[model samples]
Target: MSATGAAPRRFRHGLVVGKFYPPHAGHHALVEAAAARCAAVTVVVAPSRRESIPLDLRLAWLREVHAGTPWVRFVGRHDDHPVDYADPAVWDLHCAVFADALGGESVDAVFSSEAYGGELARRFGAVAVDVDPQRRAVPVSGTAVRADPAAHWRWLSAPVRAWLVRRVVVVGAESTGTTTMARALAERFRTAWVPEYGRELTARKLATLRRSRPDATVFDVTWDRDDFVEVVREQQAAEDAAARVSGPLLCCDTDARATALWEERYLGSSSAEVRAAARRPALYLLTDHEGVPFADDGLRDGEHLRAWMTGRFRVELAASGVPVVELRGTHEERLATAAAAVEDLLAAGWAFTEPLLPAH
Candidate 1:
């Protein structure tokens, strides 16, 4: 098929400016639209110190989202001006900063979704190109995402979504349905989940032991402090990697905090490294092992250690200062209870997670 339409309005350069506090799908669409019309485009991420999300993270997210679009480049700097979006003086200062930021580039067009596009364009001696002013294609914004990230989760890119995602760590003693619950919750929410990394490492050690002494089982090998440290490191890395692909909420079978408990159980004490690696989870779903039948996979100690381990987990969690909810019932019932708690956390805007800075 031959081309029938007129060429897109070509420009030497185009500019898109914003804090991009948390870039959404709409911002991406606008950047794409600008790139389609211009030879080159630069996205300005002007963030202030007052924002919760830092400038570097926002810049990295923009780069990730627009990685394939080579013509689209990002230039970020701190916006030191006061928070006065409606004031003309503020706009003038932004224009000066934007112009200074675009050193030698000839910006002939400015793109935006807000009404300020025209004024921004006039300041740069460029034509204003408004894309999705009504936001019909992507009916979402940074404000909406910040207000309720879980509600507008679909609109966020992977990296940005990961930043806002809260992990609901399913942690407890052995023989519980932590893995099963994590998988089910991930499937239910259509997101990613982190499996217990310590299990895999322990399995590897057991495999080596069997090869060396064919009669040995997983439970025969005793782990040292370094082993526990490695487990904590691997577990935290897995959770982080999973969160990048997870939507708004990450379902973690176990977290570093659990690794700390396991270390205390096996090694008689927890390592400082393991405890430090433990991140504060949005919610902890403690699966009670009472009704659940204890099944040994040759790795876990028998039901005799369940009460002791569960008690230690409770004590450790209390000291670590993470929210906990003790779940009791069948697998399905536990899932329902966990799902409700997660919903409540999201509804409350994740008040449990501490902020980067304390409020006055």
Candidate 2:
């Protein structure tokens, strides 16, 4: 309300334009400000074709982050036009792209944090609303994020963080310390770890069978191709969920590739659908079954097949072309080895292709 007790003015529609290279808190702030002052807001996510991140992915991330704001609509436009702040022709070309994305609707206000916000607003015949022009609010930029995403991880939303998090999968035969290693690594890093979905499914299957057969054991728990596919899908979904809340590195007991191998072991072969679901993680820690003692935990029946499974994992992992580090010896030693590998992966850093630059 105003000083005179009048309600605050609100525009019919607001417009926000940005590359949104990877939407950060600052971008969210700008959009939020627009939403607060407008009946409806349209966030135009304009990125060049040469940008590393897909335009669709940018739209999805922004839309998810602002899902609660039903009035805020996110639209994408591929603007390959050369960026030249000094050239009116370039401005016209870019505005044309933005206009087309909005279906030629009139913009009531142009919200931005850039120096050219006023000019852009003038082109649209809308009011110029500067939002944190000095970056005092969020204190971050896409350039800084792209340079070191780990350092700017907190500024990113869950979906963007999930995409940037380095995933390290710990895979091995039954009772070979895969879960232990994964949990320990997560603890060491003070991050999140994904448990084996297949194990949980196994327990569920056994419990369900016992209700009908009274004497169902782990051996009675049978698996079909659909089961493996479910495991693959659930495992990935869990990993993605964990990544959102995890630190720079995420630990996983297993992944879809491991699920594919499990499918082969049970069904005589892995199906193409299961195989296609495999996502390459940043690192794979294969726990050797040689020194580990197998314990029949009422859910495992692969003691005799441990060595064979280990061999198969090695062969498949080698063929998959993902970097694999074998963890052997005592639990302490294995944890240390896995920790070092994770540190190396973190040190290697994320490599994002540079976005197109404006003309000098």
Candidate 3:
């Protein structure tokens, strides 16, 4: 409704088209405007096949960001046609792709922020609606985002932020301060952190055993291949959920790779499925168990095997080829070391591959 008490003008159907190299706030604004002005809006995400970001991923991110708007539909199509604004033949090729994506649906309006919006509307036989043509509403561009994602991070949606967040997993032997380190790092960075799901599962298993045998101790808490698989799946789900809402850096107490090693500690061997679930994180902070006195926390039973497990983690991490930063000395020292490594990581910045460029 307007201030004059008149209903807002709307069209039956509107079309929005973009490469969406990676959908930033500007792209979202265009779609939102179309959605508000049209009864139904179709957003055509047309990226070239040679583009770095996948078409499906762009579509998924857009859908996630605009989930509240049910009237907006997103479609992905690979438009590898050469981009030449002055070439009519090239424009025709691109329009053909966009038209095919529409599936014979008539568009009453074309909403865009590009100079080519009028031509696009003419091709679709729809009215041209320019939206934020100067980029004032959302002062960001895909090119700027691609060049340095961290600089333009504020303009990105949660899903896109999750995709760009640098995940750092803290893993080590029992009672080695992995949780403590992970928590401290999250606090230092003012970001979200994922707790070890396996620990919660352990507590649950112990409680379940107590129902049958009240005297069952941590020693009696048995595990199998399926248990490890469940831990891996839940751990990854938690990490992903945290990443979406986390700052540029996400800290984790442990990860699926650590779970595989734990599986070997209990079940005597890690399964192919368990090992396959391991994902390479941006960095690994291994808390050394050297001077840390073992305190039996009811759930921990690996006091004597701490040295062996630490060695195993070191070997596995080294073999995995992901960069590892071992934390030793007092808790404060370890935190400093981890923080320094993280600072270096953030300093490196994100590097997205260049998308398909328009012909000169």
Candidate 4:
């Protein structure tokens, strides 16, 4: 079926070939168009070793986008095939590669958007069905997407978008509403949220410590470096797992950067593991300590130390070299600022522009 909804000459088998480095809407249109016209469609993903994403991942993205479309089959192998798209003289070599890749299957039509589609179709003894040869249907390409995915994010399939989803971590001192804001952001974007794991671990440790000594309080038991280290690891695991299940964005309440700061506050020193985990996120939404009244949950250190820890987060975030945007004002105002930052991230393809200081 063509994009116009008219039945093009039906073929027993149709072929669509591309590196599909990161399959965008143009590729999807080509596949859908081909699938509409052919009894069975085979899409090829040929990735070179230099491709940033592995070949298997590209295949997975294609599989996910074309899910439930039984006629759309994909072909990829773990072989270092030659990528000579520059010279037409190498066309025969590529034809042989394609023939071998397709197992010399009988093909009736070739669907593509490139000028070389005619030649590729001729090699297969099939007619070329060029869909959006001028790229008018979807004015985006893999090169443009790779250069700035967030800019062309709408041109991408949800599966591909999910793969490129950026993590925006909301980190701040106690009573800063990091949790509330993270949840709100996730809901706003209709994506997943990773809750602060460190809080849970800290609560569990405090409970155990308090139960062991009924007279002593939570803050009396000094959390060691290992405790913070475990928190960082577990936090990362939870974030990663949530990201897998998330859509185009994953909102994290807090990450290892906070763990590092807390480690410094409690243990007097942060470990290499904690510091490493505190590295750059897509962006950081830091809730400012000012204006917001400190609420002492059983877990909070107190109102006085809120500023101190907030200062420490700034120091660690700067030292860790991550992009940060501090949010102030009421909860709604902070949420708006954070949402705008996330929108900007989505527009910029999550590219990092600012320089970061080296970890000391």
Compared with the true structure, model 2 gives a TM-score of 0.93
Q: For each predicted model, how many residue pairs clash, with residues at least 3 apart or on different chains?
A: 0, 0, 0, 3
Using lDDT, give the best candidate's number.
3
Ranking by TM-score: 2, 3, 1, 4
RMSD of 2: 3.0
The stretch of ten residues in a row with the least summed lDDT in candidate 2 is 1-10
lDDT of 4 by residue, 47-77 (tens): 5565667778878888988887889899984
Worst 10 residues of 1 by lDDT: 351-360
lDDT of 2 by residue, 1-360 (tens): 011133555788999999998899999999998899899898999988888899999999999889889999999999989888999999999999999989978987888899888888889888888778889989999999888899999999999999999999999998999998999999999999999999999989999999999888998888998899899889899989889999889999999888888888888899999999988899999999988988888998889999999999999999988999999899999998999999999988888777777888
Backbone clash pairs for candidate 4 read 1-36, 1-37, 150-349
Worst-scoring 10-residue span by lDDT in model 3 = 1-10
- Could you report the Cα RMSD, in angstroms, for every candidate shown? 5.0, 3.0, 3.1, 7.6
| Candidate 2 vs candidate 3, TM-score winner | 2
Q: Which residue segments of model 2 deviate by more than 4 Å?
A: 1-9, 212-216
Give the runs in model 3 whose Cα sits over 4 Å from its true position.
1-8, 211-215
Q: For residues 1-360, what per-residue lDDT tens digits would candidate 3 score against the true structure?
A: 011133556899999999897899999999998998899999999988877788889999999889999999999899988889889999999999998999989998899898889889988888888888899989999999888787897898889988889999999999999999999999999999999999999999999999999999889999999999999999999999988888889999999889989999998999999899989899999999999999898999999999999999999999988999999999999999999999999999877766667789
What do the candidate models score in CA lDDT, each in turn? 0.81, 0.90, 0.91, 0.79
- Stretches > 4 Å off in candidate 4: 1-16, 24-44, 47-90, 96-159, 210-216, 220-222, 349-360
